[model samples]
Target chain A: MTDADLSRFSINQETVKQWSLPELVEGCGKAGVARVGLWRAPVQEYGVERAARLVREAGLTVTSLCRGGFLTASEPGARAAALDDNRAAIDEAAALATPTLVLVSGGLPAGDRDLRGARERVADALAELAPYARERGVRLAIEPLHPMFASDRCVVSTLGQALDLAERFPVEEVGVVVDTYHVWWDDTAAARIARAGAAGPGGGRIAAFQLADWVTPLPAGVLLGRGQLGDGSVDLRRFRELVDAAGYDGPVEVEIFNEGLWARDGAEVLAEVVERYAAHAL
Target chain B: MTDADLSRFSINQETVKQWSLPELVEGCGKAGVARVGLWRAPVQEYGVERAARLVREAGLTVTSLCRGGFLTASEPGARAAALDDNRAAIDEAAALATPTLVLVSGGLPAGDRDLRGARERVADALAELAPYARERGVRLAIEPLHPMFASDRCVVSTLGQALDLAERFPVEEVGVVVDTYHVWWDDTAAARIARAGAAGPGGGRIAAFQLADWVTPLPAGVLLGRGQLGDGSVDLRRFRELVDAAGYDGPVEVEIFNEGLWARDGAEVLAEVVERYAAHAL
Candidate 1:
């Protein structure tokens, strides 16, 4: 227990998706875990202000808000609505006092095959939003989902591409999430993570670091195939080391999206997450 | 039908996995298809000499052999066994008078996570086998599987990585396979194809061009999720143009692994493949 400092450990609510905001906050507080990463739906459902006060009262930190960007909509009306939604998300993050708002760049627009066009639109949307994020003291964290999701989820499929987009804005206003499950397969990830931290304007640039393993025979549809730590092929500890080497001293959020994990009790899942994080991600 | 010449079209038998060697050759001959790509097991089962004679008698061109490399085995005994297998595949290609042998670099060694190590060994194996392939008048084509297969199936995940490895050997001895199903999501694929053909010591060095579309709700295992032509997101026509622009005028082989397509009658599947190839791949 001498080196078991869980200060930087956090649980993303999606890992225990069935848990309510209040229960999650109370659970983390009781477990001596200091931080929780929240999703937009539950917070809005529970009332963002109440959720914020609940966590504030429980002395639990809000590591990050689930998402804010789907800015690749091609239709003018839909695109405008996405931006408006992102604005609201940023405001919610501000209300929750979370320093980072995760952004999953929208996939290709329906009936649209232009991936490059979609990625470019994400950059343009960021330019519009970075000032807002900066004004609120929140960094927009662009999450680079795996290439498997390139067509349907997030077009920012590599850490190098995420940094390419993140660099266009100030480091303080925008940054990248080095989620183990997403960027693990990337050959250049270690170097890119290093560059993300060192090459940014003032250094210390990684906004959020997440942990999720990758297991094969990916479940049908593949979205819920994220493996629990130590259950798959990814060298999770190495990723932790890489981010640490890049001088990123921040919350390492556990973010699994597997059906099996989601089927379990929240406290039980949180206990195993902490154990695996210490063993596989430390 | 004036412009519907299929002189450069070939169907890998796995596209009709239910068909036998003699039946496949006869089916291609019946369909007015001149070229056919082949797999190792069925060829061996039918006897290489017999299969070669059968295709030759049927006036069918053997474009390429299915595969010859799984050189990432770390155990000395297993590694030696894989090489022996690949060497035999090359000898079979030579006997069949096939112009190319496709290579699928194996996945990570069992219980091992060093992907870079496995990839480097693929290079080592290629260096050993390239001269043997060249001496047999057969070129080895490195097929880069999609990034999704980076862990459990194939470590060579992108066209760029394939070209990087193939360029280390002579152009005639080694070349790259441009498979749309495997590489459609890659952002730099078009550029990589151009480099593959134009930058080799010998110009126009692409050894094989494979076509398969991508579909969603990928089945349980995800391996058999390849869509039928004109059935998914990939712009197969644009890929054909990219390969054409790269100066590849060789056989455009249709190699799909799908449950639904495999369940249909082989002749019916072949007919539909021809129609779809003309529409989506021309």
Candidate 2:
């Protein structure tokens, strides 16, 4: 396939986690993949400026930064620390020249059963950081993880809920991430995708569109079990069509976290992803 | 606590799976828990009639039968077999004198991506079984398993979706199950619980209410990670209050499937469940 065929394609760093920052840039450059989604840890490890320069010089675009939210911490000191860390993440995303900072809103605090309250804390955190992110020319993308992670990873478990929170702020400053693996199960996702795509006062609420398949017999912890494209039940093309209909023209980032994918050669995995995106997600 | 305190409490058989029919009946009798929810497999293995007689002799009530759905088969032979098996389950539920039969609507057929099609098949199966269930004096309670199981265990992954399916039939013929473990993470659960509790054309649509806590680091397979009451993030007492407010005075069944709980002495587990229920779920 020509590069034009994969124009919107972006490789999320976690999908080929075995590759270092330099290897990732080199790999994507060789594969004709123009975009990459970087995780904060690896970027921080490589020195954000150095990693940014590496991708920039290699003619690769940073589509989005991995994450910046864990705002469910309610204790005074912990809340401050979370917000501070998120600010740092936004700075890193800005330095990397990425437009989006993906946020997995944290889950309930220890022994806390107040899901609504935890979610409110997320909204509060967003209010505190939205301005900082806006000033940095970075948009914060709220990602509603699958409901299974509601208790431990993110209380935002549906696209509708993410929209609810995102609508409270300017669409340019705050938006939602539609990760197929997380929302493909919900019947309301299509409508919500449309809503996020629809132009609001600021712009489209849709910031980042991610792709990962949902395979069965989820591995332990359920965190690293994301299936490779075409390996699970999600209809990736339908999601792409829905997002396209909703007016989103951003990078389509493949972000699988399967152990099996990680053990393979990074370039080989990237090649297969390119082929699979053409086969299953075009 | 007095027997009056646990008057609404029901021990789901799977909670103490190590116990046989006789042990379960005796344990419930001694523990002052007057009702028990049962699984079809163990009941059939123990002989439905004999098991029914044993519970009757022990003066214990059978609150509900474990399951009767998986109605997502597409092939004609498999669909017919699924209907026949559900009819058999209805017969067993009737024999056991339980008014409710929990249904876990099956996931998508293997290699299929049409989730809406799979869901429609569940509706068709319900239509086929509803009349039979009504005639047998059993209500098919559609249990929306957690979204994590959307691809393998159940496609109805939200209370709202379950109600949409259940509302299609006469409330007496079909209803929705509000299992806290599966729905606690949902922001709309409280409102949906009210809808399920509201008096519709055929009375309240809530056929059964089950309880299990949401624990972390979900085990491999993610099926048996249900935590003991009060050991996880669910607001159990709030769920009870919501169900109660919705005018559902039916049994509040505690169903857990943790390996730790299963490995413990059945009596000790039962006793601990009673105490935890009193402390957290009452």
* Index of the highest-TM-score prediction: 2
Give the distance in Å from residue B232's predicted Cα in candidate 1 to where it truly belongs: 1.6
lDDT of 1 by residue, A93-165 (tens): 9999999999999888765667788899999999999998889978999999988888788888888889889
Clashes of each: 0, 0
For candidate 1, the C-alpha RMSD (Å) to the true structure equals 1.9
DockQ scores for all predicted structures:
0.71, 0.90
What lDDT would candidate 2 get against the real structure? 0.92
Q: Ten residues in a row with the worst lDDT in model 2 chain A?
A: A194-203
TM-score of chain A of each: 0.97, 0.98
- Indicate which candidate wins on lDDT: 2
What tens-digit string does per-residue lDDT give for candidate 2 at B1-282? Answer: 344488888999999999999999988887888999999999999999999999998889999998999999999999999999999999999999999999999998999999899999999999999998888899999999999999998999999999999888877788889999999999999999899888554228888889999999899999999999998999999998898888888899999998899999998999999998889888
Candidate 1 Cα lDDT to native: 0.88
Model 2 docking grade: high
Residue A241 alpha-carbon offset, candidate 1, angstroms: 1.8
Q: Please give each candidate's TM-score.
A: 0.96, 0.98
Query: How large a fraction of the reference contact set does each model reproduce?
Result: 0.60, 0.87
DockQ (0 to 1) for model 1? 0.71
